[model samples]
Target: MTLTLTVSDDVRALAPGFTHVAIEAHGLVNGPSNEAGSALLDDAARRLAARLDGRAPHEDPHEDPHMAAWRQVYTAFGSKPSRTRNSAEALAKRALSDAGLPRINLLVDLYNAVSVAHLIPVGGEDIDRIDGGMRLIRATGREDFVTVSGGEETVEHPDAGEVVWCDDAGVTCRRWNWRQGPRTRLTEKTTSGVFLLESLAPMPVAEVTAAAAELAGLLADFSPGADIAVRAPESSA
Candidate 1:
Protein backbone atom coordinates (compact mmCIF):
# COMPACT_ATOMS: atom_id res chain seq x y z
CA MET A 1 0.00 0.00 0.00
CA THR A 2 2.49 2.61 -1.05
CA LEU A 3 1.25 6.06 -2.07
CA THR A 4 2.93 8.00 -4.89
CA LEU A 5 2.86 11.80 -4.69
CA THR A 6 4.24 14.37 -7.10
CA VAL A 7 4.38 18.06 -7.97
CA SER A 8 4.02 18.82 -11.68
CA ASP A 9 6.28 20.93 -13.82
CA ASP A 10 3.56 23.55 -14.34
CA VAL A 11 3.25 24.13 -10.59
CA ARG A 12 7.02 24.32 -10.17
CA ALA A 13 7.31 26.72 -13.04
CA LEU A 14 4.63 28.90 -11.49
CA ALA A 15 6.21 29.10 -8.06
CA PRO A 16 9.91 28.29 -7.98
CA GLY A 17 10.09 28.44 -4.18
CA PHE A 18 7.28 25.97 -3.65
CA THR A 19 8.12 22.89 -1.60
CA HIS A 20 6.09 20.19 0.14
CA VAL A 21 6.76 17.75 2.99
CA ALA A 22 4.86 14.49 2.96
CA ILE A 23 4.25 12.16 5.92
CA GLU A 24 3.00 8.59 5.61
CA ALA A 25 1.86 7.00 8.85
CA HIS A 26 0.17 3.74 9.70
CA GLY A 27 -1.19 2.02 12.85
CA LEU A 28 -2.72 5.24 14.11
CA VAL A 29 -5.38 5.14 16.81
CA ASN A 30 -7.99 7.61 15.66
CA GLY A 31 -10.50 8.64 18.28
CA PRO A 32 -11.59 11.58 20.35
CA SER A 33 -8.82 13.88 21.52
CA ASN A 34 -6.59 12.64 24.33
CA GLU A 35 -5.44 14.71 27.32
CA ALA A 36 -1.87 15.41 26.17
CA GLY A 37 -2.74 16.08 22.53
CA SER A 38 -5.69 18.24 23.48
CA ALA A 39 -3.47 20.26 25.79
CA LEU A 40 -0.92 20.83 23.06
CA LEU A 41 -3.59 22.02 20.63
CA ASP A 42 -5.09 24.36 23.21
CA ASP A 43 -1.71 25.89 23.99
CA ALA A 44 -0.97 26.39 20.30
CA ALA A 45 -4.32 28.05 19.72
CA ARG A 46 -3.80 30.50 22.55
CA ARG A 47 -0.32 31.44 21.35
CA LEU A 48 -1.54 31.97 17.77
CA ALA A 49 -4.47 33.99 19.03
CA ALA A 50 -2.10 36.17 21.00
CA ARG A 51 0.05 36.74 17.94
CA LEU A 52 -2.92 38.11 16.01
CA ASP A 53 -4.32 39.85 19.10
CA GLY A 54 -6.75 42.65 17.92
CA ARG A 55 -5.92 42.69 14.23
CA ALA A 56 -8.35 41.47 11.60
CA PRO A 57 -7.15 38.84 9.13
CA HIS A 58 -7.74 41.03 6.08
CA GLU A 59 -5.19 43.58 7.15
CA ASP A 60 -1.69 43.43 5.71
CA PRO A 61 -0.23 42.11 8.95
CA HIS A 62 -2.74 39.25 8.99
CA GLU A 63 -1.42 37.93 5.68
CA ASP A 64 1.21 35.21 5.75
CA PRO A 65 3.88 35.48 3.06
CA HIS A 66 3.58 31.75 2.40
CA MET A 67 -0.18 31.98 2.06
CA ALA A 68 0.19 35.05 -0.10
CA ALA A 69 2.10 32.94 -2.58
CA TRP A 70 -0.87 30.59 -2.71
CA ARG A 71 -3.06 33.56 -3.50
CA GLN A 72 -1.00 34.01 -6.62
CA VAL A 73 -1.61 30.38 -7.48
CA TYR A 74 -5.33 30.93 -7.09
CA THR A 75 -5.13 33.98 -9.30
CA ALA A 76 -3.40 31.97 -11.97
CA PHE A 77 -6.29 29.56 -11.80
CA GLY A 78 -8.88 32.31 -12.43
CA SER A 79 -10.08 32.44 -8.82
CA LYS A 80 -10.21 35.62 -6.82
CA PRO A 81 -8.35 35.62 -3.52
CA SER A 82 -10.93 37.87 -1.82
CA ARG A 83 -13.63 35.32 -2.56
CA THR A 84 -11.74 32.08 -1.95
CA ARG A 85 -8.94 32.36 0.57
CA ASN A 86 -6.42 29.59 1.06
CA SER A 87 -7.16 27.26 4.00
CA ALA A 88 -4.35 28.54 6.19
CA GLU A 89 -5.45 32.13 5.74
CA ALA A 90 -9.04 31.31 6.57
CA LEU A 91 -8.03 29.34 9.69
CA ALA A 92 -5.69 32.06 10.88
CA LYS A 93 -8.41 34.64 10.37
CA ARG A 94 -10.84 32.57 12.37
CA ALA A 95 -8.32 32.25 15.19
CA LEU A 96 -7.60 35.96 15.09
CA SER A 97 -11.22 36.94 15.53
CA ASP A 98 -14.06 35.56 17.66
CA ALA A 99 -14.64 32.56 15.43
CA GLY A 100 -11.81 30.57 17.10
CA LEU A 101 -10.65 27.14 16.02
CA PRO A 102 -12.79 24.17 17.02
CA ARG A 103 -11.61 20.64 17.63
CA ILE A 104 -12.53 18.15 14.93
CA ASN A 105 -10.80 14.77 15.18
CA LEU A 106 -7.32 14.08 16.50
CA LEU A 107 -5.60 14.23 13.10
CA VAL A 108 -7.51 17.29 11.89
CA ASP A 109 -6.97 19.13 15.14
CA LEU A 110 -3.25 18.40 15.14
CA TYR A 111 -2.79 19.67 11.57
CA ASN A 112 -4.98 22.70 12.19
CA ALA A 113 -2.91 23.60 15.23
CA VAL A 114 0.25 23.35 13.17
CA SER A 115 -1.28 25.35 10.34
CA VAL A 116 -2.15 28.24 12.60
CA ALA A 117 1.04 28.17 14.62
CA HIS A 118 3.33 28.13 11.61
CA LEU A 119 1.07 29.95 9.12
CA ILE A 120 1.50 27.11 6.62
CA PRO A 121 -1.18 25.21 4.74
CA VAL A 122 -1.28 21.56 5.77
CA GLY A 123 -3.41 18.91 4.04
CA GLY A 124 -4.21 15.38 5.25
CA GLU A 125 -5.80 12.68 3.11
CA ASP A 126 -6.83 9.15 3.89
CA ILE A 127 -4.44 6.99 1.92
CA ASP A 128 -6.84 4.06 1.72
CA ARG A 129 -9.49 6.24 0.16
CA ILE A 130 -7.21 7.75 -2.45
CA ASP A 131 -7.43 6.12 -5.85
CA GLY A 132 -3.99 5.47 -7.33
CA GLY A 133 -1.48 8.28 -6.65
CA MET A 134 -1.78 12.02 -6.11
CA ARG A 135 -0.31 14.87 -8.13
CA LEU A 136 -0.15 18.63 -7.80
CA ILE A 137 -0.87 19.96 -11.27
CA ARG A 138 -3.00 22.25 -13.37
CA ALA A 139 -6.49 20.95 -13.93
CA THR A 140 -8.20 20.14 -17.21
CA GLY A 141 -11.62 21.50 -16.08
CA ARG A 142 -13.46 18.17 -16.55
CA GLU A 143 -12.24 16.40 -13.41
CA ASP A 144 -14.75 15.61 -10.68
CA PHE A 145 -14.44 17.12 -7.23
CA VAL A 146 -16.66 15.31 -4.75
CA THR A 147 -17.46 17.53 -1.82
CA VAL A 148 -20.14 18.12 0.80
CA SER A 149 -22.00 21.37 0.79
CA GLY A 150 -24.96 22.14 3.12
CA GLY A 151 -24.95 18.54 4.29
CA GLU A 152 -25.30 17.28 0.72
CA GLU A 153 -22.74 15.49 -1.38
CA THR A 154 -22.02 17.30 -4.62
CA VAL A 155 -19.52 17.34 -7.44
CA GLU A 156 -17.64 20.39 -8.66
CA HIS A 157 -15.08 21.00 -11.38
CA PRO A 158 -12.02 23.19 -11.53
CA ASP A 159 -11.36 25.78 -14.19
CA ALA A 160 -9.03 24.78 -16.98
CA GLY A 161 -5.39 25.20 -15.99
CA GLU A 162 -6.34 25.74 -12.35
CA VAL A 163 -3.88 24.39 -9.81
CA VAL A 164 -5.20 21.31 -8.03
CA TRP A 165 -4.28 18.16 -6.14
CA CYS A 166 -5.67 15.19 -8.00
CA ASP A 167 -5.64 11.41 -8.29
CA ASP A 168 -6.85 8.75 -10.67
CA ALA A 169 -10.39 9.40 -9.42
CA GLY A 170 -10.56 13.17 -9.82
CA VAL A 171 -9.68 16.39 -8.09
CA THR A 172 -8.76 15.89 -4.46
CA CYS A 173 -8.29 19.58 -3.78
CA ARG A 174 -9.22 22.56 -5.87
CA ARG A 175 -7.37 25.86 -6.21
CA TRP A 176 -4.27 24.35 -4.65
CA ASN A 177 -5.06 23.97 -0.91
CA TRP A 178 -8.32 25.82 -0.77
CA ARG A 179 -10.73 22.91 -0.11
CA GLN A 180 -10.47 19.14 0.12
CA GLY A 181 -12.68 16.63 -1.63
CA PRO A 182 -15.17 14.66 0.44
CA ARG A 183 -14.10 11.29 -0.93
CA THR A 184 -10.58 11.38 0.49
CA ARG A 185 -11.12 13.37 3.68
CA LEU A 186 -9.75 12.16 7.00
CA THR A 187 -12.30 10.53 9.27
CA GLU A 188 -12.48 8.35 12.40
CA LYS A 189 -11.80 5.24 10.34
CA THR A 190 -8.59 6.69 8.93
CA THR A 191 -5.77 4.84 10.67
CA SER A 192 -3.15 5.44 7.98
CA GLY A 193 -2.81 8.61 5.92
CA VAL A 194 -0.59 11.04 4.08
CA PHE A 195 -0.05 14.62 5.26
CA LEU A 196 1.50 17.42 3.22
CA LEU A 197 3.02 20.65 4.51
CA GLU A 198 3.18 23.26 1.71
CA SER A 199 5.43 26.27 1.85
CA LEU A 200 6.76 29.08 -0.32
CA ALA A 201 9.63 31.53 0.15
CA PRO A 202 10.78 33.44 2.53
CA MET A 203 9.57 30.46 4.51
CA PRO A 204 12.61 28.40 3.36
CA VAL A 205 12.90 24.65 2.79
CA ALA A 206 14.59 24.20 6.18
CA GLU A 207 11.59 25.67 7.98
CA VAL A 208 9.18 23.38 6.14
CA THR A 209 11.36 20.37 7.02
CA ALA A 210 11.39 21.42 10.67
CA ALA A 211 7.62 21.77 10.64
CA ALA A 212 7.20 18.29 9.17
CA ALA A 213 9.48 16.88 11.85
CA GLU A 214 7.41 18.57 14.54
CA LEU A 215 4.23 17.00 13.15
CA ALA A 216 5.90 13.58 13.00
CA GLY A 217 6.90 13.98 16.65
CA LEU A 218 3.36 14.85 17.68
CA LEU A 219 1.96 11.90 15.76
CA ALA A 220 4.47 9.64 17.54
CA ASP A 221 3.42 10.91 20.95
CA PHE A 222 -0.28 10.48 20.22
CA SER A 223 -0.24 7.21 18.31
CA PRO A 224 2.64 5.57 20.24
CA GLY A 225 3.44 2.60 18.03
CA ALA A 226 2.43 4.02 14.67
CA ASP A 227 4.86 3.48 11.80
CA ILE A 228 5.67 6.90 10.39
CA ALA A 229 7.84 7.84 7.40
CA VAL A 230 8.85 11.44 6.65
CA ARG A 231 9.51 12.39 3.00
CA ALA A 232 11.61 15.50 2.76
CA PRO A 233 11.55 18.50 0.39
CA GLU A 234 11.69 17.92 -3.43
CA SER A 235 10.54 14.31 -3.11
CA SER A 236 7.98 13.23 -5.73
CA ALA A 237 6.77 10.27 -7.71
Candidate 2:
Protein backbone atom coordinates (compact mmCIF):
# COMPACT_ATOMS: atom_id res chain seq x y z
CA MET A 1 0.00 0.00 0.00
CA THR A 2 1.17 3.53 -0.78
CA LEU A 3 1.43 6.00 2.09
CA THR A 4 0.21 9.54 1.60
CA LEU A 5 1.80 12.66 3.11
CA THR A 6 0.37 16.15 2.97
CA VAL A 7 1.07 19.59 4.41
CA SER A 8 -1.82 21.78 5.52
CA ASP A 9 -2.38 25.12 3.84
CA ASP A 10 -1.98 26.95 7.12
CA VAL A 11 1.38 25.35 7.77
CA ARG A 12 2.55 26.26 4.26
CA ALA A 13 1.63 29.86 4.89
CA LEU A 14 3.55 29.81 8.14
CA ALA A 15 6.78 28.62 6.55
CA PRO A 16 6.81 29.64 2.91
CA GLY A 17 10.04 27.80 2.16
CA PHE A 18 9.34 24.38 3.58
CA THR A 19 10.32 21.47 1.34
CA HIS A 20 10.41 17.76 2.10
CA VAL A 21 11.28 14.47 0.45
CA ALA A 22 10.12 11.05 1.53
CA ILE A 23 11.82 7.71 1.12
CA GLU A 24 9.84 4.52 1.48
CA ALA A 25 11.56 1.23 1.99
CA HIS A 26 10.62 -2.39 2.61
CA GLY A 27 12.57 -5.49 3.57
CA LEU A 28 14.89 -3.47 5.75
CA VAL A 29 17.45 -5.13 8.03
CA ASN A 30 17.73 -3.22 11.26
CA GLY A 31 19.75 -4.35 14.25
CA PRO A 32 22.08 -3.19 16.97
CA SER A 33 24.73 -0.64 16.08
CA ASN A 34 27.96 -2.10 14.80
CA GLU A 35 31.39 -0.98 13.62
CA ALA A 36 29.99 0.04 10.24
CA GLY A 37 27.27 2.17 11.78
CA SER A 38 29.69 3.79 14.18
CA ALA A 39 32.01 4.64 11.31
CA LEU A 40 29.16 6.31 9.45
CA LEU A 41 28.37 8.47 12.46
CA ASP A 42 32.04 9.37 12.83
CA ASP A 43 32.27 10.43 9.22
CA ALA A 44 29.10 12.49 9.56
CA ALA A 45 30.51 14.31 12.58
CA ARG A 46 33.68 15.12 10.64
CA ARG A 47 31.61 16.45 7.77
CA LEU A 48 29.60 18.63 10.11
CA ALA A 49 32.73 19.92 11.76
CA ALA A 50 34.17 20.85 8.39
CA ARG A 51 30.96 22.58 7.44
CA LEU A 52 31.01 24.64 10.63
CA ASP A 53 34.52 25.82 9.69
CA GLY A 54 36.03 26.68 13.07
CA ARG A 55 32.80 27.56 14.86
CA ALA A 56 33.12 26.72 18.54
CA PRO A 57 31.32 23.55 19.59
CA HIS A 58 29.59 25.61 22.28
CA GLU A 59 28.29 28.13 19.74
CA ASP A 60 24.61 28.18 18.94
CA PRO A 61 23.80 25.89 16.02
CA HIS A 62 20.83 28.03 15.04
CA GLU A 63 23.29 30.65 13.84
CA ASP A 64 23.45 28.62 10.64
CA PRO A 65 20.99 29.74 8.00
CA HIS A 66 19.09 26.46 7.82
CA MET A 67 18.68 26.16 11.59
CA ALA A 68 17.78 29.84 11.84
CA ALA A 69 15.00 29.29 9.36
CA TRP A 70 13.67 26.42 11.46
CA ARG A 71 13.88 28.57 14.56
CA GLN A 72 11.82 31.24 12.83
CA VAL A 73 9.16 28.66 11.99
CA TYR A 74 9.08 27.37 15.56
CA THR A 75 8.65 30.88 16.87
CA ALA A 76 5.80 31.47 14.43
CA PHE A 77 4.04 28.48 15.97
CA GLY A 78 4.55 29.77 19.56
CA SER A 79 7.38 27.38 20.34
CA LYS A 80 10.65 28.38 21.98
CA PRO A 81 13.24 27.27 19.42
CA SER A 82 16.03 27.29 21.99
CA ARG A 83 14.14 25.09 24.41
CA THR A 84 12.63 22.79 21.80
CA ARG A 85 15.08 22.49 18.96
CA ASN A 86 14.52 20.70 15.68
CA SER A 87 15.91 17.18 15.36
CA ALA A 88 18.75 18.15 13.06
CA GLU A 89 19.95 20.95 15.34
CA ALA A 90 19.68 18.66 18.35
CA LEU A 91 21.72 15.93 16.65
CA ALA A 92 24.24 18.48 15.40
CA LYS A 93 24.87 19.57 18.96
CA ARG A 94 25.63 16.00 19.99
CA ALA A 95 27.85 15.48 16.97
CA LEU A 96 29.88 18.50 17.98
CA SER A 97 29.92 17.56 21.63
CA ASP A 98 32.73 15.59 23.25
CA ALA A 99 30.28 12.86 24.22
CA GLY A 100 29.37 12.40 20.52
CA LEU A 101 26.17 11.09 19.05
CA PRO A 102 24.41 8.19 20.73
CA ARG A 103 24.09 5.03 18.70
CA ILE A 104 20.48 3.99 18.80
CA ASN A 105 20.34 1.15 16.26
CA LEU A 106 21.50 0.59 12.71
CA LEU A 107 18.55 2.24 10.95
CA VAL A 108 18.22 5.12 13.39
CA ASP A 109 21.95 5.69 13.42
CA LEU A 110 22.00 5.73 9.60
CA TYR A 111 19.33 8.42 9.31
CA ASN A 112 20.81 10.42 12.19
CA ALA A 113 24.06 10.40 10.27
CA VAL A 114 22.39 11.92 7.24
CA SER A 115 20.67 14.50 9.42
CA VAL A 116 23.89 15.71 10.99
CA ALA A 117 25.98 15.54 7.83
CA HIS A 118 23.50 17.47 5.69
CA LEU A 119 22.17 19.62 8.51
CA ILE A 120 18.57 18.80 7.65
CA PRO A 121 15.81 17.29 9.76
CA VAL A 122 15.22 13.61 8.86
CA GLY A 123 12.75 11.25 10.52
CA GLY A 124 11.60 7.69 9.98
CA GLU A 125 8.33 6.01 10.90
CA ASP A 126 7.39 2.37 10.91
CA ILE A 127 4.93 2.15 8.04
CA ASP A 128 3.19 -0.89 9.45
CA ARG A 129 2.33 1.00 12.62
CA ILE A 130 0.84 4.05 10.91
CA ASP A 131 -2.95 3.97 10.88
CA GLY A 132 -3.54 6.18 7.85
CA GLY A 133 -2.08 8.92 5.69
CA MET A 134 0.23 11.38 7.41
CA ARG A 135 -0.51 15.11 7.50
CA LEU A 136 1.40 18.12 8.69
CA ILE A 137 -0.87 20.68 10.31
CA ARG A 138 -1.33 23.14 13.14
CA ALA A 139 -2.73 21.30 16.12
CA THR A 140 -5.74 22.40 18.19
CA GLY A 141 -4.13 21.10 21.41
CA ARG A 142 -6.66 18.30 21.76
CA GLU A 143 -5.00 15.59 19.72
CA ASP A 144 -3.77 12.48 21.55
CA PHE A 145 0.02 12.25 21.70
CA VAL A 146 1.12 9.01 23.30
CA THR A 147 4.72 9.11 24.40
CA VAL A 148 7.12 7.69 26.96
CA SER A 149 8.22 9.50 30.08
CA GLY A 150 10.34 7.99 32.90
CA GLY A 151 10.15 4.58 31.19
CA GLU A 152 6.38 4.44 31.51
CA GLU A 153 3.80 5.04 28.78
CA THR A 154 2.16 8.43 28.88
CA VAL A 155 -0.22 10.56 26.88
CA GLU A 156 0.33 14.26 26.19
CA HIS A 157 -1.29 16.99 24.17
CA PRO A 158 0.44 19.43 21.89
CA ASP A 159 0.10 23.15 22.52
CA ALA A 160 -2.63 24.86 20.56
CA GLY A 161 -1.42 26.21 17.22
CA GLU A 162 1.71 24.11 17.41
CA VAL A 163 2.83 22.29 14.27
CA VAL A 164 2.63 18.48 14.32
CA TRP A 165 2.65 15.41 12.12
CA CYS A 166 -0.41 13.22 12.58
CA ASP A 167 -2.41 10.40 11.11
CA ASP A 168 -5.78 8.81 11.79
CA ALA A 169 -4.51 7.59 15.16
CA GLY A 170 -3.13 10.88 16.48
CA VAL A 171 0.03 12.94 16.62
CA THR A 172 3.11 11.17 15.32
CA CYS A 173 5.51 14.01 15.84
CA ARG A 174 4.95 17.11 17.92
CA ARG A 175 6.55 20.53 17.74
CA TRP A 176 7.34 19.92 14.08
CA ASN A 177 10.09 17.31 14.44
CA TRP A 178 11.15 18.28 17.94
CA ARG A 179 9.73 15.01 19.32
CA GLN A 180 8.30 11.86 17.76
CA GLY A 181 5.60 9.89 19.48
CA PRO A 182 6.47 6.31 20.38
CA ARG A 183 3.64 4.56 18.62
CA THR A 184 5.02 4.84 15.10
CA ARG A 185 8.74 5.03 15.76
CA LEU A 186 10.89 2.53 13.86
CA THR A 187 12.21 -0.26 16.02
CA GLU A 188 14.81 -2.99 15.48
CA LYS A 189 12.06 -5.28 14.27
CA THR A 190 10.80 -2.85 11.67
CA THR A 191 11.19 -4.07 8.09
CA SER A 192 9.31 -1.31 6.30
CA GLY A 193 9.50 2.43 6.94
CA VAL A 194 9.06 5.90 5.55
CA PHE A 195 11.79 8.48 5.96
CA LEU A 196 11.16 12.20 5.65
CA LEU A 197 13.85 14.77 5.00
CA GLU A 198 12.86 18.40 5.57
CA SER A 199 14.45 21.73 4.70
CA LEU A 200 13.74 25.44 4.39
CA ALA A 201 14.82 28.37 2.20
CA PRO A 202 18.42 29.68 1.98
CA MET A 203 18.96 25.92 1.71
CA PRO A 204 18.22 24.85 -1.85
CA VAL A 205 15.72 22.09 -2.55
CA ALA A 206 18.41 20.30 -4.53
CA GLU A 207 20.48 19.96 -1.37
CA VAL A 208 17.59 18.33 0.44
CA THR A 209 17.22 15.91 -2.44
CA ALA A 210 20.91 15.20 -2.26
CA ALA A 211 20.60 14.39 1.41
CA ALA A 212 17.72 12.05 0.67
CA ALA A 213 19.71 10.40 -2.05
CA GLU A 214 22.61 9.81 0.31
CA LEU A 215 20.25 8.27 2.83
CA ALA A 216 18.74 6.01 0.20
CA GLY A 217 22.19 4.86 -0.79
CA LEU A 218 23.10 4.03 2.77
CA LEU A 219 19.85 2.17 3.24
CA ALA A 220 20.52 0.13 0.13
CA ASP A 221 23.98 -0.79 1.34
CA PHE A 222 22.87 -1.72 4.81
CA SER A 223 19.66 -3.44 3.84
CA PRO A 224 20.54 -5.13 0.61
CA GLY A 225 17.71 -6.13 -1.69
CA ALA A 226 15.36 -3.84 0.18
CA ASP A 227 12.78 -2.17 -1.99
CA ILE A 228 13.64 1.49 -1.56
CA ALA A 229 12.00 4.36 -3.41
CA VAL A 230 12.42 8.13 -2.95
CA ARG A 231 9.72 10.66 -3.67
CA ALA A 232 10.66 13.96 -5.25
CA PRO A 233 10.92 16.96 -3.01
CA GLU A 234 7.58 18.71 -2.43
CA SER A 235 7.38 22.37 -1.50
CA SER A 236 4.93 23.17 1.28
CA ALA A 237 4.77 26.76 0.21
- What lDDT would each prediction earn against the true structure? 0.82, 0.95
Tens-place lDDT per residue, model 2, 87-188, is: 999999988888899999999999999999999999999999999999999999999999999999999999999999999999999999999998999899
User: What local lDDT score does residue 147 receive in model 2, on the 0 to 100 scale?
Assistant: 95
User: Which residue segments of model 2 deviate by more than 4 Å?
Assistant: none
Give the poorly placed runs of model 1, Cα more than 4 Å off.
Answer: 49-62, 235-237
Highest TM-score scorer: 2
Candidate 1 local accuracy as lDDT?
A: 0.82
Best-performing candidate as measured by lDDT: 2
